[model samples]
Target chain A: MSSSFDPSKYPELKNLLCSIDKIPDVSDIRPETVTEKVIECNSNCPDPRLKTLLDNLTIHLHDFIRENNVTTEEWMATVHYLTDVGKKCTGSRQEFVLLSDIFGIAALVNSINNPSVNGSTVATLLGPFYTGEFHDIEEGGTIAPAEGPGEPLLVTGRILNTSGEPIPNAAIETWEADAEGLYDVQYSTYSEPDHRGRFRSNDKGEYSFRCIVPIAYAIPDDGPVGDLLIKLGRHPYRPAHLHMKIEAPPVYETLVTALYPRGDLFSKSDAVFGVKTPLIVDFELIESDEEAKAKGFKKGPFRRLDYDFTLATKEESAQAKEKLRKSMAKKA
Target chain B: MSSSFDPSKYPELKNLLCSIDKIPDVSDIRPETVTEKVIECNSNCPDPRLKTLLDNLTIHLHDFIRENNVTTEEWMATVHYLTDVGKKCTGSRQEFVLLSDIFGIAALVNSINNPSVNGSTVATLLGPFYTGEFHDIEEGGTIAPAEGPGEPLLVTGRILNTSGEPIPNAAIETWEADAEGLYDVQYSTYSEPDHRGRFRSNDKGEYSFRCIVPIAYAIPDDGPVGDLLIKLGRHPYRPAHLHMKIEAPPVYETLVTALYPRGDLFSKSDAVFGVKTPLIVDFELIESDEEAKAKGFKKGPFRRLDYDFTLATKEESAQAKEKLRKSMAKKA
Candidate 1:
């Protein structure tokens, strides 16, 4: 035991331990010879987490190369495949995000970071195509353009403090797909602006909006991200829902929530895994033509939803913002 | 201790210690919220190694976000950027592989798995663009079809077993850039179908090929991978070299190696970190007009290199192949 522990023999022992003793002469080796080359090349990674990840990756990658005895031609094919994925990105869509989403990394990160909440909204993947900055509107004002397609929806929601007391004023930024299930950002044919708006609640802590009930649609699939999904046998559809961010005074929490249409097939299996139980609520189908007429909507029928949000206290708000800022800086 | 552990009095503690308790309302909790999230998220990671990595990554990611307090627009920009990287991949070249290279993932993986083999050749990144299926050529034949730009070179090498015995009939595959420092695949102008070729050693374990000396060149830019490199402040160049792979009988190991030309500055800092000390060899500039004339080449000068490679024993060869196979299967 003592002999084995001798540090003076480390060089030789390490050779044996790593199984590099009697190193092969420079010729007559397999195509997998590059495996060691790769491992040696990446040895300098400094971050411990990255170090471990890379190390494990190397072992697996090398093992992969050797196991298949991968030919030089096959390796080259992989390179070409990856190059196409890079060429497919555009302003409106990202293939890589779809790649990550399909690979489960996006879901994994969201799941790891967002713990469950009881009697409150659950967080989900924010997705890759959410364009920020919305036109602010007054409470109860109609935000969706008149020409946009959708059954008028009267969306009313309250911003409440953690103690269940109403917060007098809160800003709620909302966006969603049109009746045809397409966001304005996804279609160039639509007007420069449609189907998205921001509203501030009144002193009564209530905000309302009028827009058509959005449809459920599939994520884009004509790109490399789509190709990968097909290769992996997965669909790219997301459940129907309205995205919102509710913010009040520093004492109240800012809620990033999505209210899904009840009983959508994709509600249980969101592509990015963003759905939470609390965020699932009923979209009541009202048959009262009188009610639709009172709201200045078409006389056929309408859907209505009322969502109440509870915010965290002031100190928590500051901390959350600070944490988010730090993470963003690091990424930059 | 009993008081601190009370379920009714300290709901957060109770929730954390046992899964039966109600989900803790982490929102609006102040600085502790971030810390709690980190701990909670890390606790769910199943892999012990990954768990530790996630813990550190969360801390850093969170810190960066908080420091920058990045707007949703900026976050969306990042998402789009990554998406483009995914879209850029084709069937051959992978932008993500290049991304990983520039971000150090490639090098990190290389080093962690390649323990030092004192006398054995070191490996490097195979890169995102190495296509296989080289043309087959007879021993003492040429890989170059046309003059192909560079001065003609006579490369001769030997394949030997680990015990120093010559291994006859070893297969060798070779490829490299021309005088312009571009592979045929990189340019549509080059119509040389057999620029790359595979050969087998003679009974004396000797092999020779006629080809132009390859020059150093920069990796491709003008894409998302390029943008990332610019952001990270890195150059994209590799030194002059010839890529070679050798395989023989089961008695010895198989080898994939690159023979770098002596006196290239970038050899020391190969962008892909593929340089190996043992693999570096001198290509003599033959000034003998008589020698050049005898070889049917331009009379003033040419280059020649002689290299010999030794392989490990059979058991080691099997182990390496097994490892490679496992890794390759995982990707498939």
Candidate 2:
């Protein structure tokens, strides 16, 4: 223990300066050997998995500095930027997620963990908006508020297994932005959750909910992440998409994914990299008043989306994730 | 501009969503191609230098993630950890700098920026203790308070140019921790600074001051950085050292460095990677009452540190830095 470590001086910290017999002393550090010294410093981590992650992180972080010849000024500026990013976090906003999203790291992690399995519906980003606070509604009920701000859309989908059989009682939660491309959570008027709902698949595996048409929306642009995007000369627009999460648990691996609307300008360059080829769908415009009335809409010309989600069993998904990871490692 | 970007909704953001004609739309992103996509997202950065840095950053960061197969949970954990680190910063404390120091990045940056030139002194980490707030003191005056802690020590050094000529009137600032290994800035009782002083070299390039001997100190251990050190199996102790900054700007580059005492256990592995072999010095113990009283100490036995610093002219130092950076790049 450092003799100077007074418990009263650092009440927040645990007295962890015990025997370091497991840690090896490092040699003198120079530019050429500092990375090695740092690596050896981390070699005493008890968790082997965490140790590997930190080791790789150090290797890449140091390499970035050396390759770019990054100056102290540039590094300090990055530190300030990151500090601003952290300060911008709130209950409804996550600037760090936006940071990862803009860099496509979130997409890459999604791809790595949710690799394709047995023709199941491809998964995408969970985004930064899922609050998991929606009240459960009956099938065919409306998730949109009674006085919502957009054209009504009816989303109906059947949950099926890879072998083409119904998977009943699966929970599905969905959320989206209003006509102004703003989520309820993004508004000052937001009190209770809006434009979101939870429902369960019936015995026939059918699910339906009424919602406003999702529009292209910008990720929060008043934060450090937005500043970074602007500095990179990129737009902050994500294509129109509906966020969905379905879970059967124990038997089925929960599917966290989204569906993007086709023909959106930003679909080709969704700021968050949440778009995948298979996840894109077209909404058919139904202009029949009789059908609209049956669907509890006051008028016609509402959008209609009919799709089916194929889910992979837990065992199948585990196998696919391991196989893909091993294959990627082999390729590397 | 994104059509969904409403100015009223995001009043904090400048209306920066302009034409991205310079930004080419990216293709479909997959695990294998997300890195390429993200890199191209930054291709439109106007500053070519910044663009290169971002490109290289994307390459290395993505490589780290893919090579390690970082999962969403692990990535989110990292995000939260960074947020905590940022939140821990204050007027006196810089958690980010500590983060860099422990990883040896601060040392690497210091090494890269201040490469040796013509037998001039090598530099090390400036550390997080410097406040640049010391009051001026006459040569041979005591910097320690009348009722300070620890044994007395006398520090005398000469400032010289590379050719061994005296560099008169160079301003030198020095500071150190108390016997308890804590700086005045770290204490609740601290108001006016103690144990630090600023002085100028005389015509003979001689500078001297009296201070209490600095003891090995632990970096702030109540924060996220201390928690990280414990997890990494490393100690937070830096060797006992006196921090110094000598400036003769315009003619010579300012030098910010420290002198480590020999025989300290942590000297070989300074927690912040600030130790350099050349900067380690032996403090001679003198038991002569006449000499001790002559140095204005209250007692006989006292420690004396006599070390001279050699500096390079600004032009010489700049050339050396550029040469080292280029050579490092070539080696990489």
Query: Best TM-score goes to which candidate?
Result: 2
Q: List DockQ, one per candidate, in order.
A: 0.08, 0.46
Candidate 2 regions exceeding 4 Å error are A1-27, B1-3, B6-23, B188-190, B288-290, B298-300
lDDT of 1 by residue, B1-332 (tens): 00111234323334333542222222222222444443443343335543443344444444333333334444446567766666655554467677656544454444333322324445555565557767787665677754555678888878876566778898887887656666776775545445688888899888888787777776666678665443333345566778887777566555666788777645654556666667778888898989876665656587889888776665754565456556656755
Using DockQ as the measure, the top candidate is 2
Docking class for candidate 1? incorrect
What are the chain A TM-scores for all the models, listed individually? Answer: 0.71, 0.93
Tell how far residue B102 is off in model 2, in angstroms: 1.4
